[model samples]
Target: MFTGIIEATGVLKELTLKGGDLALRVQSHNLDMSDVQLGDSIATNGVCLTVVAKHSDGFSADVSNETLGLTRFSQYQKGQKVNLEKALQATSRLGGHLVSGHVDGIAEIVSSNSNGRATEYWLQAPENLMKYIPYKGSVAIDGISLTVNAVEKNRFKLTIVPHTAQETTIADFKVGTKVNLEVDQISRYLERLIQGQSSAASESTLTTGLLAKAGFIK
Candidate 1:
């Protein structure tokens, strides 16, 4: 798991293609790697990648085809900047929301505008994923945890402070830029619980009418 708090920004140093996978090497830019080790998980642009090799200034990880298909990794190029966050430790403070580092879908920046010291960005999420994004709720965009300022049909707005813009890759975002998105994990679990209960109820004699008769509903 990750806290979605970007520790630093890294550059994609190289991308090597193997059979059906990709080997990624990223150069750390001020990110502390003294505690990192081989086999440790790192959240690169919101996608959890296991470190296969470690160097003085960077690390290498292998990206499978399945992860590539679900994320914007295919669109990345050498020298591109990406948000970087180390996996959360039990003793670490919960500065940001809980992030699985699992990209649910890709979202595109629809618009951007300066909002005084902050920048308001509107992003269009996938139709199916929009249900998970709610106003005032949390969403991780390219590994940076942000609150949804507003929500439209299939889009949501986020206000990025100057500190966030400088700390992460959000400063480099532009219209049409694709970003990896991870919705709130709690919402997903709640949906599954509700759905499972509904399914079980459908098979039994419990119905809305019965509940109303029992004064459970008005």
Candidate 2:
């Protein structure tokens, strides 16, 4: 599991897609590699990938075919910047909400506004995600946890402060760019609650009508 918090940024070195498996190599100077071993899971742009190899300047992970089909990581090109986060440790703080480090789907950046200190990423999600995004809801974009600053039709905006931009690659957002999106987990819980309430209401109404016909109640 991850907290959707980005720790650093890296430049893509290789996206080797062969035999239906993807091997990504990226250069991150901030990641302390001295302790990282092979087979460790790292969150790359919100996708939890296992480390296949490690080097002084970078590491590589095998991306499953399913992950490639579902996320924008497959669209990454050489030298592109990407968000990076290490897997959550037992001792790490749970700053953000529970995140599986799984990319549900890709969302498109509709617009952007940049100031020197901050940049805003406006994105349009698919129809399936429209009901999940709400005002002040938590969202993970390319693995960075952010709040919904504003929402439009199938669209939402996130304001990236300078600190967040520096830690991740969100400062480079541009129109038409694709990003991995994960909605708040609480939204699913809410849906379940609504379904349960509807079921209870239907049963109550049926019982009431039966009782009235039998003269047990008016």
Candidate 3:
């Protein structure tokens, strides 16, 4: 789990594909990786990845084929900047809402504008993923937790302050760029429960119909 509070911007040093999996070598810029150990989970661009190898600059993690296809990591290249955050510790502060570091889907940045220090970003998400993009709701974009400034159908806008821009890689977003998105955990859990109940209700209705058709009900 994570808070979506980005601690630093990291650089992608190398990305190697071996045995149909991705091995990422990154260079942490001012990110403290000393506390990270092998097998530790970390969020890179809002995707929870396990540390396979460690170094002074950064650690390497293996990305499965499913993860690659589901996330924007497939589009990343060497030298690209990425947001980094350590796993949520028990003693850590909840500066942002509950983020699972699990990317639900990718969103496309329709427009990005910066004035002096603040930034305004408008992105279009998938209909299935827009349930959590309510106004003032918590959404983690590329590993940085931000509030929705406004929402329109499957699109939403965000206002990034100077501290967020300077501390994270969101400042590098451009129009047409893709980003990893993690919805609020509360919303996800609630959605899951609602879907479960709906499915159960549908199954019960189907059973009743079957019974009536078989002359069990008059």
Candidate 4:
């Protein structure tokens, strides 16, 4: 698991293709790797990758085809900057929301604008994943944990402060830039729990009508 707190911006030094999988070597930048072991997991742009090899300044991980298909990593090129976050330790503070580093889908930046000292970005998410996104909820965009400022249909808005923009790769985002998105884990678990209960409930169906009847909606 990760905290979605980006520790540094790393560079994709190389990508060697082996069959359908890829071996990626990334420059660690300012990320401390002294405690990182060979089997440790690192969240690279919100995708959890296991450390396969260690180097003086970086590490390498193997990327499966399934991960590539679900994330924007397939579009990444050598020298591209990526957000990096080490796995959360038990003693570490929960600075951001819990992130599994499992990319649910890819989202595209539709628009961007300045909001006082912060930059607000409007992104369109995959239609299948829209139900998991909610206004005022948490979403990890390219590994940066941010709050949803607003939600409209399959799109949502996020506001990032200057510090966040400077410390992570989010500052480089532009219109149409693709990003890895991980929705709140709690939402997925709740959906599963509801589905399980609904399967057992005969008249107590679970649907939009049920939500409205329960006063969860107006």
Model 3 accuracy (lDDT, Cα): 0.84
Which residue pairs clash within candidate 4?
none
What candidate 2 gets wrong by more than 4 Å, as runs, is: 114-117, 189-218
Tens-digit per-residue lDDT, 1-218, candidate 2: 88888777888888887787778798899877777889987888888888889989879888888888898866778898877788888999999777778787789998888767778878999977767788888988888888898998889988889888767777677899888998887665545554466575452233345546656568
- Per-model TM-score on C-alpha atoms: 0.90, 0.81, 0.87, 0.91
Where in model 4 is the C-alpha error above 4 Å? 197-218
Per-residue alpha-carbon lDDT of model 1 for 1-218, expressed as tens digits? 99989998899999999887899999995888899999999999999999999888879999999999999999899998989998999999999999999999999999999989999999999888887888899999999999999999999999999999998999889998989999999877655555466575453343457546656568
TM-score of 2: 0.81
Query: Over the stretch 75-107, how does candidate 4's per-residue lDDT look in tens digits?
Result: 889998999999999999999999999999989
lDDT (CA) per prediction: 0.90, 0.80, 0.84, 0.90
Best of the candidates, TM-score: 4
2 or 3: which has the higher TM-score?
Answer: 3
Candidate 1: where is the Cα deviation over 4 Å? 197-218
Residues forming the 10-long window of minimal summed lDDT in candidate 1? 198-207
Better by lDDT, candidate 3 or 2? 3
Residue by residue across 89-188, what tens digits does model 3's lDDT show? 9999999978887789999999878766788989999987786677989899998899998999999999989888788886677898888888888865
- Residue 209 lDDT in candidate 2: 59
